[model samples]
Target: MKNEINIIIITPELSKEGGGGIAIYTQILAKELSLDFEVERVVTLKERAVVNRVRVLFLSIVKVFYLLNRKKRKIAHIHTAHDSSFFRKSIFVRLCKIFKTPVILHLHSPSFALSFKKKSEKQQENIRKVFKLADKVIVLSKREKEWYLDNIEKRPPLVVYNGMNDLISSSDKVSERRNTVLFLGQLGHRKGTYDLIKAFKKVLENYSDAKLTLAGDGEVDECQKLVKSLQMDNSVEFLGWIGLEKKRELLNSSKIFVLPSHQEAFPLTILEAMSTRLPIISTFVGGIPEAIENNISGLLINAGDIEALSRNILKLLNNTLLCDKIGEFARERYLTHFKLTQTTENIKKIYTELL
Candidate 1:
């Protein structure tokens, strides 16, 4: 085995300050990879930091050229979207082929073919061509990996579930709890913020003492309006955006954790909640089933089923025994599979094997 492996991870959009799942995943994974490899991150701030198109294009070109000429024997691992066409085939992909080094495209989203097919046939064909260029593809969920293997021939992907760092200790577990529900993540339709609000309305019917706390920000006006229109001001609380300390505080104090997202590859918040011994009630989408067992570790309801969502929320709140069991089971699951130590070891092995 080589003494060290040099790897470069390039992403179009990377924010060190924003509250995005991809950013957090990249941060943690990068830190872990650094323990065993010489990992350098090259990020392009597309619209957030750059205003001039020429400057943005020039910066991307410089970054690529720097990676291409930096060393001869290092791997250029790129984080790219599936449909990032000519840019991928001619720029990043072509560079790897030129250097005679393997390229790993770690994908976070679903196939562009599937998403583009909903838009137009021509768009789908364009996306299909882009998929044919990747040397090795990485997906976060089994569903996503299977989708690629089933649709695309000769370019199968490796499935690796996103991992979260363990932030809680044995002493962090609390015996006392209040009647509070925590929802962390974007306040948008696909995240199921609206669905959670609707379910919270029904949940409040029986559990009048319960309060709902909403964290993270997106489409703020719409979510705020929905809460006001439902006359749930007294029961609902919104904290626009919070840091690590406040997030942990909310998770620790809350009685139940809920995430009703319609689409997700994997959620870092779910693992965070489980790490703190919080019972999760989430929608059955993406790799959620891999984390939560229906009615075992937690409850999993349909994406848009408000009635079932409300029912489960109420069930967990009313029955303290069920809540304790689920929360305990969730924490155990986190310790058993999602802990960062094992995740880092597995990832380190993959890097060494590639080297």
Candidate 2:
């Protein structure tokens, strides 16, 4: 076998507690990157038990020193987001620069652009400096790339859509799923759970059998209260952070998949929904539009528009032919453009080109 290309990845969270989008993305990405590159990953976020800030700082300095001291040539792949995350990863970025190591800042935050605006001019300059130091900057979608250009004067950032495995084949394109509209993400305002609830209220007027299953963690208590207040307890179900098998089971069983999130950076769950051949109803925010063609592969609506959301939900639920057509087209789109293999290959190419 060819001796692999050496690369070191530093991420804030590696364990399950830290298992947000970045954790899932890192696990799959490192695995794929390892096929052609020798990857050394560093998880900065400590376990449940932690000491004071001084101790954390000392430990971080020591870890960076150790990683930079390695004899082999490797790109420092820094995964960063907003606020404290930027500060922490900035340390690694500066260290890589000090050691003359090539750096690639893989930005994966939807709130990153907004956060940049919150910072002072000096702080924003420092953030831009961090971007400039990188040998290459990777953003999630075309929208994100534009945002970066607008904020930071640097080389055009690269766009890489997050990818997942496709579940349904062309032959298995038909969806026999129940009249359930599934929302698979964290439960909160940013995810549009409240709007989904309101929209489902409208949906109930037409098809009383329609069910909305939200399968993730976040603000669940508040969500429970909202459901009770709205008197939708029976129709809305919160599975509370399900495992992969349970998620797949729900995706397979559900007829419609809806993610009304007001913010995103090319969500992997939407791709997961597309893979399962579920007709999608998501907001037009972020890079979701890049993956979904409005009324073609999936229906896109304005964020917080409960009426429009419910209208699409009702449309798909009533028309079996339209639902199946969209679902089949979505799966076909996934196979054509958004497979995990394609993502891995594109990433591999980027690495080779950079070298």
Top-scoring candidate (lDDT): 2
All models: lDDT? 0.75, 0.83
Instruction: Report the Cα lDDT for candidate 2.
Output: 0.83
Q: Write the per-residue lDDT of candidate 2 for residues 9-47, one digit (tens) a residue.
A: 777553354467887778777887787778877776644
Q: List per-candidate RMSD values in Å.
A: 2.8, 2.2
Query: Which consecutive 10 residues in model 1 have the weakest lDDT in total?
Result: 81-90
Q: Which regions of candidate 2 fall more than 4 Å away from where they truly are? A: 14-18, 46-61, 169-175
Residues 1-355, model 1: lDDT tens digits = 3345577776654333452765567667778777767777765434444454347656766877776677545676666554442244336666666677667777765334456457566755555555566566777777777777776555767777667876664444433688899999878888889999999999888989999999887877899899999999999999977788788788888899999888877788999988988889998888889888888888999999888989888888888888888888998999888887776776655656666
- The clash number for model 2 is 0
Question: How badly does each model clash, as a count of residue pairs?
Answer: 0, 0
Q: Which TM-score value belongs to model 1?
A: 0.89
In terms of TM-score, how similar is model 2 to the real structure? 0.93
